[model samples]
Target: MRKHLAFAGFATALLMLAPPAVASADKPEPRVSGSMSGTLPKEFGPWAGEPVKFTIDAHGRPAGVKGTFKVFHDRIDGSKPVGDFEGKITCLAVAGEVAVATGVITKGYVNILDKPTEDVTGKKVSFTVHDNGRDDRIFWIWEFMGAPVNDCQGTAPAFKPARGDFTIRG
Candidate 1:
């Protein structure tokens, strides 16, 4: 009876520790997606509004990003979209509530003085998405205007939205 009791206690301890490892292994990676539209500095003329939609799935390994980055002048409002940039996001690096996604602009276009022009092609686009409720801010790399940060790493820029909504999940 004494030997049997000791074996049962050891078995119970083993059973208790076994499930957690299995449970953790079964955990799935968080999904990443967002719809963001915000404003940039007016001093940077010809381009004033920035809108990004991150709707993608398992890209390579850990995370994926797919979205359209568009820009419009402040005067246009809801009329038309200028600088429609669509591409595959190459890198998505996250820290806390902020995520920086970077990719090359496979295809893009802009309008110069109401004339459609093929511009901003083959350029790197990196943007930051903040997922902190009210404090949430949406912003991206303005390479033409010399944005401070590029690629999806380290500290990034966060621009408070003067309009639209941003939904980011990770």
Candidate 2:
């Protein structure tokens, strides 16, 4: 019984000398979390006369985000082509002024063809967000600087423009 007690005491001392299992407090802070989405106004140059909608769904604090872009034509008559885009994205916060995200479209479709998604699948799309520090009335928006469509297939819009703005009002 005395030997058993000594062995147990030694084991308890060893455990006290061992390192901790996790170090969560030593890790850096995670990125902010939320979703941002909105529609492009008619004056948006690239989609001047079309109704385009954009969405940026953040996967997590660091897995980046996935975006969905769509455009619809004046179609009570069903006489126009639709544009759709979906893929992964990476965003970087500016010097306290903006958050810029850019990535390639790797999925989704446009019109009757999947060309737009395929064309830009491996290509890059740049999106920018300007937060005026006010969440009152439509101030935080992500703007598209450039997203070109290449290697198109089937019946599709000849020009793929990527100059529109998206907003998340909360």
Candidate 3:
């Protein structure tokens, strides 16, 4: 009779300590996608200016050119894109033709960068435009610029376009 009581107590304890069985199998992970778009202001400065309003298409192409400018992204610390900019008219004309255009993220803000990394073969000093858009090829570039560490930190940096150079292309 004592053995029966001990066995009953042991079974009760085991039942209480056992974990509940899972109801179903684990669900699959979710897939994420990135997007880009914006508008360019009628007047703006390439540097030393505020964020100009520009309509950046989903394909990452800039239209309405009033002046000569070139835009591209640069990888900072070999980790991710930290900065990008639209080059001056003279620079863009000399750099090369616009082969491909696409929107991308370096640190966080939407930016346009080169399509083929192999095409951007140059000294890593400043942003350079490798492809010209005259060819009419659709390109897409997207990257996640990490979030800020603190409130004191500023938002992601982006390239500024000079005023009187905004022109829309067909």
**lDDT score for residue 67 of model 3:** 28
Candidate 2: give the clashing pairs.
105-121
Best model per lDDT? 1
Q: Pick the candidate with the highest TM-score.
A: 1
Which of the two, 1 or 3, has more TM-score?
A: 1
The C-alpha stretches of model 3 lying farther than 4 A from their native spots are 1-26, 40-82, 85-170
Write down the worst ten-residue block by lDDT for model 2. Answer: 149-158
Give the runs in model 2 whose Cα sits over 4 Å from its true position. Answer: 1-46, 59-82, 110-118, 133-170
> Cα lDDT of model 2 overall?
0.40
Could you tell which candidate, 1 or 2, scores higher by lDDT? 1
Question: What C-alpha RMSD separates each model from the true structure?
Answer: 9.6, 15.3, 19.5
Q: Report lDDT (CA) for all predictions.
A: 0.55, 0.40, 0.28
What would you estimate as the lDDT of candidate 1? 0.55
